[model samples]
Target: MIAIDNKLISDEVLDEQFVCDLTKCKGGCCEDGDAGAPLEDWEMKEINDHYEAIKPYMTPEGIREIERQGKYIYDKEFGWVTPTINGAICAYGFRDEKGIIKCAAEQAYNDGKLDWKKPVSCHLFPIKIQKSRRDPDMEYVNYEPREDLCKAACSLGEKLKVPVYIFLKEALIRKYGEDFYEALEAVAGYKKNND
Candidate 1:
């Protein structure tokens, strides 16, 4: 399971030998299918707006592709209420000159033409933030330091250089609040067994 929290973990632990070897596996995360995570109302709105803005650049087939997958519903209390699509890959997924899969969103962002309202989930790859089903108010676990398994399981893992925990904390705090940062910190520390 993916870990989500606001507490900061020591970078030292992050650098520990326990970190899984990622090179052995392909990026299963990018290619296997759509891995659903929650989204806020604002998040949904952003994604919709982006889709509209980029609609001209997108072919009808592209639009239909995403539409066929359906949109994710959001709930105030529950956060992202549903993942209506299956095998949902990001709009930006493509191969590079080196034959590695790269995110189009990142490329667009770098190109300075990306719609800021795109779903945060679209940009936040590998890293995921989920509210605890057992305790919605409480953030979930911090780090899922299973790079080896993740790389093996996720087809896009090879290109996913950033640590999942790092991305999750940064994305959550940016989208949510400082509370999320604190939660991530705690979880990071815990993952290190730092107490």
Candidate 2:
């Protein structure tokens, strides 16, 4: 593990390879999960604030589910998460013409409807972060690509020689700032040179 500040990052971030193959997977990660994409407390407010602006990008069913379930729901196992359509796909996700699940919030953001992107959890997919159980102030950054959903990503990553951390550079920086990302990169560079 690479320790940085209050976080412990798993070695898999540098060793494991991954690059989302949207054509092959069709954004399965967005829809195949048992719960909706995880949300921070502030993200719930962002959804509530930008609902009208983002509603146009969302499916009718998603809007209805949001109305029925309230913007986000508290999960027993995962704390807060976006509401799903009847416990299926995320209510914020819409199936496109190519059958890929697209995030309405992200679409809205790209269209200049809101400043916030989709949930950080969604952006940082294949990599999950959680508060450390042993130390309340510490966090754990883990590489956790789904075996069934991410097979193509893994294969492509190997072909491209892109490490999991490299594949997630933007997301990591977005979530943890550039310092953390540089720290991870430095570790990767050091390991590569020594090995």
Candidate 3:
């Protein structure tokens, strides 16, 4: 593990390669999860504040689900999370003509209707965060490749020689900060040379 700022990062983040193959995966991660996308308190507030703007981009069912669930819901295992439609696909998801699920929140963001680009948790795909049981302030940030859904991404990453950290640079920087990402890059370089 690599210690950076307040988080402990797994080596797979540096060693493993990954690049989302959206065409192949069809955004199945948004639909296949047992639970909804994890949410922070602030994210819940953001959704509530911007629901009207985001609503135009979502499915009627998704909007109804979100309204019925009231922004976010708590799961016994996953804490606070976005609501889902029929206990599947995220309430903020819509299917494209290609039969792939896409994020409505992101569509709104891209359209300049909102500043928030989807939730940080969703932005930082394949890198789930866990708060330390031993130290409340510490977090474990690791690469969690969902093999079934991410096989193409893994293959592409390896073919392109792009490490997971590099592929996820924008999201990581969004969740952490530019300095944290710079630190991560430095560490990745060191690890590459030392190994």
lDDT at 75, model 3: 93
Error of 3 at 78 (Å): 1.8
* Stretches > 4 Å off in candidate 1: 1-28, 33-38, 53-62, 71-88, 115-127, 145-169, 176-195
Write candidate 2's Cα lDDT for 77-178 as tens digits. Answer: 888999998778899898889999999999999999899989999999999999977888898999999988899999999999999999999999999999
TM-scores for all predictions: 0.52, 0.97, 0.97
Q: Who is ahead in TM-score, 1 or 3?
A: 3
Error of 1 at 180 (Å): 5.6
In candidate 3, clashing pairs total 0
Comparison by lDDT, 1 against 2, better one: 2
Candidate 1 Cα lDDT to native: 0.46
Q: Ten residues in a row with the worst lDDT in model 1? A: 13-22
Give all candidates' CA lDDT scores.
0.46, 0.91, 0.91
Expressed as tens digits, the lDDT of each residue in 135-161 for candidate 1 is 657544333434544545234423554
For model 2 the local lDDT of residue 145 reads 90
